[model samples]
Target: MFVIITYDVGEKRVNKVCKKLREYLTWTQNSVFEGEITKSLLMKCLNEIDQIIDEDEDSIYIYEVANPKNIKKQVFGQEKNFDELFL
Candidate 1:
C-alpha cells in the first residue's frame, strides 16, 4: 500500500516524530512522508506517533492509496529529488 503521512505537531516534538517516521516512510516534504508500507506496519507507525504527539496540540493525517499507479502527483515549484527513494 502507498501511504502519505502529514503532521502538524508542536515544535519540540516535531523532530522526534519525523525521526521515527523516517524509519518506515520517505520524507517527501517538510512534515510530510510517503511510501509503501504494510497495513500492519502502518498501524504500528500510528501507535508510535500517538505516543510522541500531544493530543490537544498536534494532529496527524494519513492518506492511503491501495494502488500507486492510480495516483497523480504534480509539482509547481522547485522539487527536491526524492524520486529515487520513492521509486
Candidate 2:
C-alpha cells in the first residue's frame, strides 16, 4: 500500500519521530513523508512512533490509497529530485 504521513509532534520529540519515519518512508517535505509500505511494516512504523510520542500532545495523519485503480495520485508544486520508485 501507498501512504502519505504527516505528523505534528512536540519540539523535543520531533527529531525522534522524523528519524523513525525515515526507516519506512521518503521524507517529502518538512513534517511530511510518503511512500509504499507493507501493512506489517506500516504497523511497525506506527508502533515505533507511538512509543516516541505523547498521544495527547502529538498527532499523526495517514492518507492511504484505498483503491489504486480508481484513484490517481499526483504531486503538484516543486518536483522531487529522485525518481518515483524506491528500488
Candidate 3:
C-alpha cells in the first residue's frame, strides 16, 4: 500500500511526523510512504497522523494497491497521473 501525505506543517513538526511514520513505513521517494499495512494498522496510523497534525494544515492520502496486474494501466490514466505529473 502507499500513502501520499501533504502538509503545511512547519519543518520541525513535519520532521516529527515523518519520524513517527518511519517506525512503521519505509520512506519512498518524494514524500510517498509505503508499507505492508493491515486495515486496522493503516487506520490507526492515519488517525495518529491526523492527530499529530491536527493543528496544522495537512492532507493525507491513502491508496491501496488492489490490482498489481493493472497498476501501470491504472497509473497511466489521466485522472491518476495528474498529481504525479508535477513530479
- Ranked by TM-score, the better of candidates 2 and 3 is 2
lDDT of each: 0.90, 0.86, 0.59
TM-scores for all candidates: the values are 0.89, 0.81, 0.61
Per-residue CA lDDT of model 1 for 1-87, tens digit only, reads 999999999999988998899889988788889999999999999999999999999999999998999999998897754535556
How close to the true structure is residue 44 of candidate 2, measured as C-alpha lDDT? 96
Provide the RMSD of all predictions against the true structure, rounded to 1 decimal.
3.0, 3.4, 7.0
Cα misplacement distance, residue 71 of candidate 2 (Å): 5.1
Ordered list by lDDT, greatest first: 1, 2, 3
Residue 64, model 2: lDDT of 86
lDDT of 2: 0.86
- Report the Cα lDDT for candidate 1: 0.90
**Predicted structure 2, TM vs. truth:** 0.81
In Å, residue 69's CA in model 1 sits off its true spot by 0.7
**Candidate 1 residue-wise lDDT at 48:** 92
Candidate whose TM-score is highest? 1
Candidate 1 ranges beyond 4 A from true positions: 81-87
User: Model 2, stretches more than 4 Å misplaced?
Assistant: 68-77, 80-87
